[model samples]
Target chain A: MEIIISILLLSGSFFIFLSALGIIRFKDLYSRMHSTTKASSFGLLLLLVGVSLFFNELNVYVKTILVVVFIYLTAPLAAHAIAKSYREKDKE
Target chain B: MAINNIVLLLSFSFLIVAFILAFVRLLLGQGIYNRIAAMDLIASIVIGFVLVYAVFIQMGLYIDVAVIISLVAFLGTVAVSIYLKNNTNKNDGDNH
Candidate 1:
């Protein structure tokens, strides 16, 4: 049980680190947005799952699931807004 | 138990590194869009930090904090984007 939890947590952290690295290293604005929005969301999902597993409780599972769902629903919308605005501004 | 502690510590270190990298991008980014995107990334990273801390201390309250942070971050991003779009439109109208 502990090993599973640790693996999930560590992998999630790694994905987040990769996203941050991508944000810095990517040359274009759209590409940076692309990297961050997806990678970080997935990382957060993994972390939440790991946390829920560790606790093994009803409330914790519900809370983590809620957060995961919320993030999944909103991340792309936020990215789209940012990208759309950037395109509109670029047109000027 | 010792191994679990080591894993948690490593996870925290990774998150810290990610946070610092994102901060650097926020500071040195070229434009408003880049900065805004970095800010969004930072917010998610903060959520990760909160979750790890929740696990570390064995408390559930921090999860609630994560939910609120995510909500605020999403709203801030959308608001800034709308503001940017409106500003562009106003400028275009003035030119016409």
Candidate 2:
């Protein structure tokens, strides 16, 4: 069980690393947002789940679950707003 | 125990790599939007790192910190987007 948890966490970390690479490598604003928002959001969610899995304590699991929920609710909207602003800037 | 520690260390290293990637965008980004986006990405990653750290260190407090960080980042992104929108409009007016 511990090994499984570790694997999940590492996978999440790997995806985060990939998104970061995408942020640096992508040519433009929209594409960068595309990579970072979705990839990192999923990565963080997985990481949080891994944390909950590893820590059998109820409070820790609850907190980690909250973090996951918070990210889910916020990340996409933030990225969209940012991208919209950038597009508006381009039009001007 | 040894393997777990190694995995944890590697995850931290991955976070560092993410930071470096964001730093590259900060330095070489073509525009203010790009830089701001990079900053936003960094903030999100930091929150993830905090959550992971909380798990590794077995602390519940860091989760609260992560939540606070997320809230701050959301507000910061909104403010920045508004400012960027207004600033660009002002520039357009000046050019006319």
**Which numbered prediction scores highest in TM-score against the true structure?**
1
C-alpha lDDT (0 to 100) for residue B82 of candidate 1: 97
List, residue by residue over A2-40, the lDDT tens digit for candidate 2.
Answer: 888888889888888989999988888888999988998
State fnat for each of the candidate structures.
Answer: 0.83, 0.70
TM-score of 2: 0.91
Candidate 2, residues B1-96: lDDT per residue as tens digits?
A: 213788888888998899898899889989888888888889878977886787678766677787789889989998989988888889888999
**Over the stretch B20-93, how does candidate 1's per-residue lDDT look in tens digits?**
99999999989899999999999999999998998999887788899899999999999998998998899899
Global lDDT of each candidate = 0.92, 0.83
Docking class of 1: medium
Error of 2 at A64 (Å): 2.7
What candidate 2 gets wrong by more than 4 Å, as runs, is B1-3, B94-96
Q: To one decimal, what is the Cα RMSD in angstroms of model 2 from the true structure?
A: 1.9
Give the docking tier of candidate 2. Answer: medium
